[model samples]
Target chain A: MSALGHFLETAGIATAGISLVRENTELMRPPRALWVPFELGRPFGAPHAPAFQMRVLLSALALLDRTDGPVILEDFPDDAPESDSTASLVCPVNFPKPPNPDESDLLRAVLAETASLAPWHALFMETHGRSIATVSGLDIDAAARYAAAFLEPRSNPEPPEGRDQASTLRFAIEDLRNWRLEAITAQPGPKPSSKTLADWFWGETATGALALALHPVLLESTSPRLRQVGKGQLVPRAQQHRLG
Target chain B: MVRLSDMTADDAAHLLSKNCPSFPGEPFVAGPPLKERRVAIVTTAGLHRTTDTVFDLTDIGYRVIPGNVQAADLAMSHASVNFDRSGFQDDVNVVFPIDRLREMKAAGEIGAMADFHYSVMGAGWEPHEIEPTALEMAALLHQDNVDAALLVPV
Candidate 1:
């Protein structure tokens, strides 16, 4: 999703991802927002294979300039991505899948926690440790279950005991190039009127494998809000290229 | 021949942009041109009807249009979807053409048909997830090797 913003940034298309599941929908920083709170299964991937998961990831980047309005993408099959292999089981680490916690209880926990964000966030934090941020409704437990089912079973490679180190933490904070990002500010430009905003064109300028570089900008020049966007809303278009 | 007015809000589109990079993406790929060639359509507008069993309300987005319908009839009937200030298509299939693609085939614009059209009402938040579906579909299309593909927005 960050990649989409990058491309859009270059394209002068003011693009935003539905990222404020928790705080701001800004996918990360600078030219962000448009955030929607959902699990990876529904938002971007099925589960198991990293390859398929990434395909949908890149596809989202592709939408940077495809539509004028907010774009909601589906990653599941008929309903949601089936990571049942993971979601349905407790843990694949042990020989036989461990008896899972009750789904009814789980469902209840989910419903009861609807208004509360603490437990869910706590759970994710416990399992994954921590990250810059996490989306709402991402139920890591659900992800755990899905992971168990979706990913091919890998024998436990841990040496039984895991060690914690400051180096790891320092590396994560200081050097994770992918995770480290900057918030791109919108350049001042003409703002379009409501009527004009209604006529904006959406398209993609990003391409290639992982596509971390694509970012979509809202073009206000052709619309009514061109003035506001120019002052704020509109993102400049990227370099022109021959569209055959 | 598709007038903007002809389409109901779901039929007409205000603007269109290519998802693939312009410079890198050649008009005609080495194999068959994605145009005038048999193609498959996919949608992230998250479409599935009650009858179809692919629908998921929790999946997010509008479900007015069937996301996975073959793209044959709709292309001709509704050239564009109703325009909104910030949305692609209101009724649905905002990004995939499971319908119009089929119509083109009937009209002889395309030569063959893909076995299955893909649909996902994916609220784009992550990038890794979309990769597999694309690979799966791309591989499917490659195996089928149609002249070209027509990917319309839901």
Candidate 2:
């Protein structure tokens, strides 16, 4: 955004942006920015709350008049509100986690959950007219299999062409995450919080465990990029809020 | 709050580096005062009219949305699981806020509303891909005489 904001400013358009990540915003140093305390994908506070949304928008626009130069990072005063209820946000499908004490068990468990969710995913595609796999250009099942392949006693060491090994793992991980979210959100009810969904994925299911199990493998890779991406981005994102 | 001096070397380096911009220079000239300015919204929430093409997850490009379109007609195709979608599922004003902006204009909080707003996918990581799109959007906003823009990033 800092880059784009700078480009827009050069065109003589004044811009004030609401930022999700304080670190990224600070790095790019856009001319004007409002740093909100909301999650990564939400700049506005909450759904159905117009007054709050308006306040956020108006506050961001207010930065256009500030005398600060080059970059302005203003913190929003309010924290994001809590969700109204969990019962209201219940996901109908329940894929129980199999006992996963080791890497093999974790992989097997994740595949099992994936198998359970496949029918729901298909139904979602039928109803919504599109599938997550179609949009992401990844086969969720194939991706999971790729992750599982890492656990083989002697798996191929080569990364997919034009990409490193950890990058491949990260995309496969995201593909699996997308698949699970799609299946759960497909049911007719309020969507769960990201944390709640994460808990369900890592705790109730075996997804997070599988990712944690992959960490040593990623960290031990010969490529620096593979190790960096795994340690720096992938592991932190997937298991940042691990409770166990 | 943790003092800056107490931070580890890695944390400090990351913090200092984050303050740098690609095209570093003076800030843009602020437009007219808020009361007299024409305002518009541009979001990175992956919002679009249901009929429009959904943003590719990695698309750094943008889609123009008419300012007067019904909020109900909008849909979000954002790929990140980190965002909470319940609010958007009920009312897009939480992210797009076209209706609220109109209300502000009606009440004279701002002088007028721009004829159109814009939205772009927020998950893009590459600067080269995003820069051209931003330039294109700026040109369009310039044509509309938008004095000030409120950008909502998801």
Candidate 3:
């Protein structure tokens, strides 16, 4: 992000940026930056926080008018407001545990879980007027099937048009995960924090179990792309502690 | 919460070891006052219209997001799964902040909003690898008479 700022400033346009990582910003030394204490995905403090978002925005934009020498990295004074932890998310579906350790049973559980989440996901779409699950180019059911197919010993489901198997599997898993997260969040409650949602998805959900089960299978696959996905893309590092 | 102290050791070390390109000289261009400068957002969040192509692992190119874009029309395809996305899922303003920018424009906090904003996936390439794309976007911003750019990352 700071690199882009440097390039834009060099091109004669003044640039100011929100620095999520102050160390990186200090090293690269962009023309002007406001070092925000927010998390990685959220440069502007929190969701649904307009006043705080304005303060962060104004602080960064305020740097543009400074006539001081280049490399101004100011820190935002306050941390982002914490989410309402008292209001816990109540997951609507109660997925039964797989009957056995076999991959087929896990696949069935995941499929059933996907089917159970569909209406809530539909509610998410209805409320938000959008869904990020479109990345895989497959509907929620197809994404579930495509991802679950990977557990088969020799089955290689065809990817969507113009996509390769490894990429398709990665996206299919993302779509299912996103669909599920969106679905669960649509239940009536205060918004959950990212950590809460991640914990629910990675620690308690059947889809999470399916992903954990696939990690080894993909890591052992001959395809380098699938191996790459297994190594890093399939699961977030923060949640890797949950891996069996 | 993204401070290095808050992250796992491995994650913190990975971020510390990530490449950050340095240029020869400090180049700072003087621009108009905040309320008189045309502003645009240059994000590395891999945002695009839902109908647009998804960003590949090593895609260094950028997608143009028009100023009038709706929150529901945007989607993220960033290659990295390391970052938190639930915030963005709940509110587009958390990442894109287009509505905030619009409100700023309405309140006369800035001179004007540019007609276009730019987004690129900030992974799978070296920091210097983004220079060309940045230069291209700078030219486009110039064409739109934008004097100030707010760089956002995810």
Candidate 4:
């Protein structure tokens, strides 16, 4: 959005932005930015909180009055809604882990957990009138297999049609991540905090292990930007493996 | 409470290691005071009218959101778990705030509102993919005579 905001300014449209990831907004440095401390996807503040939302919008637009500097990142002076529910987030799904597992064992564990959550995932979709499979237009099982296939040492399969090798791989990674989260969200009672889901994916699941394993395949691609993006932009550093 | 300073040292260090764009150009000034300026909104929230084609998750392009649309008339296609859309699910004002913009217009907080707003799926891993689309959206907003814009990122 910072890039878009910059372009909008160049076109004589004064612009101000509300940011979710402060580091990202700082890097791009839009003309005027309001760094909200809210979670991603809820930039205006709490759901259904009109006064707060209006305040956020007004605060961001206030930046338009700045006449001097190239950029300003003002903090939206409000505490983020307390996420007390996140204190002890536990994903409900569990697949037995094998001791001292290899890549294939980890892959199997990931797929098994996905399959185990299929029924609950379907129920979650039913309530929302949507499914991740419907959104991506790929069967969940096929998507899992597609991602897992890349983890094998000698697979080197063709990329999905219309996408280059790196993009296809990237999409696969995201697809699996979303699926895992969907399953976790489907469990009855309070959903895990977004941070917990992220931690579990990177710290507790084989999915993260697979992503780390696939880092080399992504870097070995012909596109240097793809390498930089996959290693530098796409995956978090904790989930990224060092390249020689 | 979730300040950037609250980020773990490792996560912060890793994030700071990535390249970020720096601008040397002067900031654009509102041609007139905000009360006399025309304003609009642009979001990276993948928001669109319910009747429009939903955004492809990886799409770098944009969708047009009519300014006076209803909250029930909007839908978001972003699939990240990082955000809780319960608020947006109930009232889009929590994310897009077209209604609030309209209210602000009525209250003279801003002079006028554009007839259309803009939305793009902002989840793309590659930032370069969005440049052309952003430029195109900028041209359209310029043509619309938008004097200032409020950008919301989700």
- In DockQ terms, which candidate is top? 3
Q: Residue A217 in model 3: shift from native, Å?
A: 1.0
Give every collision pair in model 3: none
Which DockQ values do the candidates obtain, in the order shown? 0.03, 0.30, 0.78, 0.40
**How do the residues A100-198 of candidate 2 rate in per-residue lDDT, one tens digit apiece?**
455566666777777877777767656555433322233666677677677655575454555446556666775576567667656666556655665
> Which of 2 and 4 is ahead in DockQ?
4
Ranking by DockQ: 3, 4, 2, 1
Q: Report the Cα lDDT for residue A79, model 4.
A: 65
lDDT of 1 by residue, B1-154 (tens): 1122433332222112112221211111223322334444444443333233222222322223332453221211110112121111111222333333454456564555666554454432343334444445445445654333333222
Runs of candidate 4 with Cα error greater than 4 angstroms are: A1-6, A19-31, A39-42, A46-51, A62-73, A85-93, A99-108, A126-137, A216-230, A238-244, B14-27, B31-38, B44-116, B119-135
* Better candidate number, 1 or 3, judged by lDDT: 3
What tens digits encode model 4's per-residue C-alpha lDDT throughout A103-148?
A: 5776777777677777877776666544333233345656556666
lDDT of 4 at A185: 65
CA shift of A66, model 4, Å: 7.3
Residue range A1-244, candidate 3, lDDT tens digits: 8888888988998988999999888888888989989888999999889999999999989998888867788999999988765656655447565544466676677778777877888898898888887888888778778888888888778998898788788888887888888898888878777888888888778788888888998999888988998998998888898777
Q: Where is model 2 chain A poorest over a 10-residue stretch in terms of lDDT? A: A129-138
TM-score of each: 0.27, 0.63, 0.96, 0.70
Candidate 2 local lDDT, B1-154, one digit each (tens):
1223433455445445543445563457677878788887888788777667666446576888998887546766664544444455445666777878888888888888999888888664555467788778888988998988887776
The order by descending lDDT is: 3, 4, 2, 1
What lDDT score goes with residue A95 in model 4?
40
Q: Which ten residues in a row have the lowest lDDT in candidate 4 chain A?
A: A129-138
Which predicted model would earn the best lDDT? 3
Measured as a fraction from 0 to 1, the native contacts recovered by model 3 come to: 0.78
